[model samples]
Target: MGNHVETLRWNGSAIEMIDQRILPHRIEYIACDSAQSVAKAIRDMVVRGAPAIGVAAAYGVALEAILRKNEASNVFSTSLEEGFKALAASRPTAVNLFWALDRMRKLWETHQAKNQPELADIFLGTAHEILEEDIRINRAMGEYGASLLPDGSRVLTHCNAGALATAGHGTALGVFRSAVEAGKRISVFADETRPFLQGARLTAWEMVQENIPVTLITDNMSGHLMSRGEIDAVVVGTDRVAANGDVANKIGTYMVAVLAKRHNIPFYVACPLSTIDLSLATGEEIPIEERPVDEIKGFRDCHWAPEGVSIRNPAFDVTPAELVTALITEKGIVDNTTLTAGELADFVKKNQ
Candidate 1:
């Protein structure tokens, strides 16, 4: 009910985001004014999640346009395009960000000739709609996702897929939360997603606040735990979902999916349809960002190495479609064996 750290919040003038690095311990706000800064914030994980970044990028571009008082249409348009490119390049993989940007661009171009002063308002309004729609989709996803789980059965999840991760209650975690509140016996085992630790710090924190039972385990320890017959289902969020159902999530998520497949466990990808990229026909086309080497070598803030130890830190990894059991969207938990943009558009229509 209170202000959540993981979601995006606007306080009239500026956009505020939670500094996730010090999360579960510190509550710091990163105030963003320009599109470049906002893009960097997302690239650095100051504000994350596909939908969140998309909405933020839309507003960031609007903010950039607003700051440019020079009404020279060419100059102002160029500035806006630059801002969009900045935000677009930040994540490279999350289709939601690009989709939201394109939506804003289309609306702006459509109204640019007739309405000038209202452009900012239109941008803000479109962003609000996007955020609201995401909440609805996630809520439906929760309900649809709940149906996937047997009543009074425990569920296992990886990463932070809850309220903090998006505009409201998260995708995969959305279903998990609804199921628990409905008096279904559920326990969540969160993989301590390493390098970034979205699981240990963000997901675990949310679970604790909600008073949901959670067992935190190291990312590598997931297979061991499941092998010991400790897991029932594996639900995780996606940075992007390929047409073939291959999921790009946090670096270790592929491993979780692999283990789930090995254990014959049900592995589900819970996400908004916006995260789906129909253009990229295959997962191999998705670019995986290899983060700073320091991420894999040492923890944030506190240094562990002597002087210079090279570290290879890849921000995300891809899980092939072969391992995914199902794709959970607002419309329903459907298998994307033959995926299409129509499925996404239909999903939106169904939610409405």
Candidate 2:
């Protein structure tokens, strides 16, 4: 299946990214001239989705190198370190950000003998390659995941895991796209994904663009819909997956997983190998991002909460390994029921 959207592109000079904050209403692109600008864009939600953020961070590193090409070795090294730190700090939950940055850092370190200008070319080229590779990875994962869905399946998803979330294609939504392409007439139920509405804003927009059958519902309505036997399966994208198969995704993902478990519906998590953090033994060790309380209190200047109300907004929640039916990756699916931490370690090693 072809990607219906291009979330990020390089123009030989700067990184151009879709501004996700105004999606489904206004389509806008933002150009990042410096590493700081790219970092700000990620933190500001101008660019998001784990894979997209990773690609953006890689470009941010490249932009830093391009801007600091004239600096002396010591000065360039300092600036490069700062650039990595800034981009990595933009979002803490996505392991892809750290993975991409680490790749760039290692590549830069390997060519330390070269001049700064020479290293600049290497950095930008590698970043471009990373973006391309991500698109390919998403497609491969899509194919593997698509097989899991039968004809006329109604998949429930949280947040926006379509093209807007990755370099192209998507993780969870990619499976749906591939399944549709394989002649399986499937529909999607997207949760509004509270405080951000990534599902309502981005997911719905992407599906409508491709003429995919989709239904928009509030986050709280997922269980009701599932109980009515309206949902056949749950497929979601994750920020990080632990060695034990635990998943950390959008805030309300855990609740959806629990509901799926109760209804005996299969809950699947779609992600690339880059999203797997084998270093973390379990989800308890995964860092969850705490967003501002104001986000829950209002919706882009529209406030509904009463005065003096206290709100807590966590960007993600960990779904225990036991809750996941299986994990869909580029390598294939790993059934959580029989999968073990040691087996996952081996899978990561062989895939890597």
Candidate 3:
């Protein structure tokens, strides 16, 4: 997912992809040669992210159509609908997953009059467009987010929002990348986001490759760092933004924002325009996804205590807009006015 959400390898009849389970450690591409296999992959998080899911769905349906003996039937349609239902059921936090999939469905139905091969080409083209546009949006976000900080600033970031998360550049990390390139000598304090270790696995990997100075610390250590005046700002990525400017991000983000607010350090929420959802009234309306207890039960699935200790893990949390300094988007960094989150979003849309 460095430069694209999903990578598809078409062997004239099948679609193959890299299994995200062992990413940034072991690179493995599994053959998603069938609709069921790909759908299961999506459900199991073998492949993920909004744009990636959409592209995967497109290819999944395409492969089904191409491999069928009878190409002029509605069987592909029925299978495609089932695949969409399965994929959409995998995760609820990232609304973009369903959004992109629905868009793909529409594109598929709209192009039904075209030849089979032509429709396949259309899906591929749509996937590629989403890929390229995401990269461009990341670059834009970097440019706009950089303007919010001064040179030689030390910043803190939570979770993973680097190239691995986006199609290319990234959202929150893109801001830091731009600052570094501008000679900001920025140091990133990474909070090893608990439960998933997205910070440790994805963020640390990105910082290492970019040669950015990064310090990894436990989730509880963030407030300590803030108290010592070691942090200048906190930037993080969001899965969804409510109409009230409340942001739902990887769990533990609300804590970081509260700390930032108390410390008087600027806290920023970086995201693409797609992450903002005007349908929801507030963060409370955002559905929180709860995972298995195994995450908090062990570091690497190994029990630390010799007992039946249960664990509670919520995938994401909501951060109120008041704690944020500015919202960085592809268009520019916009500060919310006294208006409500929904009204602010309308303002943003008009400006864009």
lDDT of each: 0.79, 0.92, 0.74
**What is candidate 2's lDDT per residue for 118-161, written digit by digit as tens?**
99999999999999999899999999999999999999999988
Off by over 4 Å in 2: 1-3
Better of 1 and 3 by TM-score: 1
In terms of lDDT, the poorest run of 10 residues in model 1 is: 1-10
Candidate 1 yields a Cα-based lDDT of 0.79
**In lDDT terms, how accurate is model 3?**
0.74
| lDDT, candidate 1, at 169 | 83
Q: What does candidate 3's lDDT look like per residue over 1-352, in tens digits?
A: 2433344454555666666566678767778765577778766666655445555665665555455425555765666667667666777888666666767778877987977677766766775676677778888889888888787778889888776665567788889888787778788889988877878877787788788899999999999989999999889888888877888888899999999989999988887777787878888999998977766777665767557765678888888888777788888776843546367667558864
- Arrange candidates by lDDT, descending: 2, 1, 3
Better of 1 and 2 by TM-score: 2
Where model 3 places Cα greater than 4 Å from the true spot, the runs are 1-20, 48-72, 305-307, 337-341
Q: Where does candidate 3 have its weakest 10-residue lDDT segment?
A: 1-10
User: What are the C-alpha RMSDs, in order, of all predicted structures?
Assistant: 2.5, 1.1, 2.9
Worst 10 residues of 2 by lDDT: 1-10
Model 1: how large is the Cα RMSD against the reference?
2.5
